[model samples]
Target: MLAFERLGIRFGGNQAVQDVTGSLTPGKITAIIGPNGAGKTTFFNMLSGFYKPTSGVITLSGQPISGRPTHEVVARGVARTFQTTTLYKNLSALENAVLGHRVRTKAGLLDALLRSGRERHDESESLKAAHHALERVGLERKAHVTASLLSQEEQKRVSIASALATQPSILLLDEPAGGLNPEETARLMDLIRQLVGAGLTVALIEHKMNLVMGLADQVMVLHHGQLIAQGPPAEVSRNPAVITAYLGSHGGGGQHGQSAPAGGASV
Candidate 1:
């Protein structure tokens, strides 16, 4: 599990994130929701080492990992997918997934140039892992398809599969369902649940209220770079600050009313 305390970062005079503190419980989905500029992705960037915190402590299990280089952070069992799908558009899905192994490979450019045995071995391992990753996302049948030719939903899965090929225990997703329709969203939900069911810990920043409310084991709310509320869906939905800041008037207000704010994802 990962835990942090009093975490914060700054850009000139802007406090992009401030005094945010939380943990990703093992085998559970933690959904982060808030209005724009709430620092949700900033929080993720800090945790994943894309950005280093100006203050606070981050520990995986019981060791410090804050500010570590991204490859080092990833080597420590954390990996992430971007809000946008970041596959190699010109490559086959399998080849794109194989790129995840680059961070973990020990063979260097010289070894590759010399055609060393280590390079071949690492490549074989990467290929095997990539195949397994595509299988995990149910893209084994389309492994050879060009990334640009795949559907948007498939591209999303391929992005996820690339992360899985890195073999991370903690997965940080930034809007995995951003553009999908209801049915596609539902299927994405099932895939998320399946990942958790198989023992991956998940944390995500998403604007889709229904996805967060229905799928998150715990929901954390942020506004203006600070955490305002965090708890189970119902409890967070009922918090007055959450309602006033991001949830709007009817967020979990009654049995018949929708808990979402105006414009399902604008919040």
Candidate 2:
């Protein structure tokens, strides 16, 4: 449901992403993998409207979405969670999740001041949605707790719930497993699989190779701001370029046609 065509981004004279092209279909997860400084996050920023692309087009379901304001992108059925967990520390978990719903309304000052039945109904619905989102991420019991009281993994789940609360058609996740333990990472992968199975399009930039290989339906490898390979995990793992760039130093052993387990592990 998300497609990029000849995408390029530059900062002054330096290009961080160049001629990138890919497609992520609905009900599927696409993983973007690359070594450090490969412009993976830069591509995500451009896609999320955080940075306008220097050249190219980003389309969602056939409509161009690139260069739109960030809020406008959210309004157009796109929502993303950052690599860092960004919850209001003092706020209750429920309150933090409900913030995602604020972008879904069309209320004005008068509506807030008057507190009409419509506003009340919307508010109630927002709470219900937020609660459901929290439950989806397995954080329902912590709804009334302060965001700061949770652990790092819990905070990441809260971030995902907040994004889901926005009801976006496409969810872009940046390194959702960055700081989690192995067990937590496995659970997160299961959650991601469940999300895509339920009809949401997910595109993620992740370094946790185990989760990516196990959960991603398609893999796109970027190196030096260009796509070096794109294919199934089995094929991408065996790709000469991908091995040399990210895996060669870590037990790749110059074997290009054998299965390689992710997460710096061997199969």
Candidate 3:
């Protein structure tokens, strides 16, 4: 399990995340939901090693990994995708996927310069892994296509494929459904479930209540950098604190200027 205890971070005088604690169980999907500025992304950044928490501890299978470098985190079975697609537009999908295997590569500068047997073996392994990742996402047919030519949904899949290539036990996805149409979103949802079924732990930060409610095994609600509610989807949706946080005093009413879906009180 990936666990957080009082995990928090401060930027200068601003406390971006504070006193948040949670655990992502293995082989399950955990969704983090909150309004803008609620510090959901901040919390994710801390987990991915983009930012170090000012106070708290993070552990993977009981081993502390709070302030480690990003590469180290990846090496320790944690890999993540961003809110925005981060692929090289000019690169083929296969090439982009191969980059994710960097942490597993053992070839040194000498191996590269001399074209040693180890370098060739690593290259062959990376190519095989990349193709497998693309196949996992149903994108193996598009391996040779440049990223820029793919549709938004396809690009998102490529990003996911890249992360999968890293062979992580824990996957962190930031807004994986951000710009997809309903059909695409549904497909992505199925893909997430399949990954969890295969024993990969998934922790996602999402604003779409429908996806969170439908896909998550557990839901965590954040407000103003603090954890406001956590439980199974049905229970968390009915929590008065969660309702108030999302809809303000108009709890059962409209979205209250929030971009969340209408009747999002159901979480």
Q: In every candidate, how many clashes are there? A: 0, 0, 0
Candidate 1: stretches off by over 4 Å: 247-266
Q: Which stretches of candidate 3 lie over 4 Å from their true place?
A: 250-256, 259-267
lDDT (tens digit, per residue) of candidate 2 on 1-267: 778999999999899999998888788889888877889999999888999998999998899999999988887878899988889999988999999887887766788899987788778888998999999899999999999999888899999999899888899999999889999998898888888787789999987777877888889988889998999887888887887776454554533333343445532
lDDT of each: 0.88, 0.86, 0.89
Best by the TM-score measure = 3
lDDT of 3 by residue, 56-131 (tens): 9999889999999999999889999999999999999999999998778999999989999999999999999999
Which rank order by TM-score, best down to worst?
A: 3, 1, 2
lDDT digits (tens) for residues 47-108 of candidate 1: 99999999998999989999999999988889898998888999999999999867778999
Task: In model 2, state the lDDT of residue 105.
Answer: 73
Off by over 4 Å in 2: 247-267
The worst-scoring run of ten residues by lDDT in candidate 2 lies at 254-263
Model 1 weakest lDDT span, ten residues long: 254-263
Clash list (residue pairs), candidate 2: none
Q: Quick one: best lDDT, which candidate?
A: 3
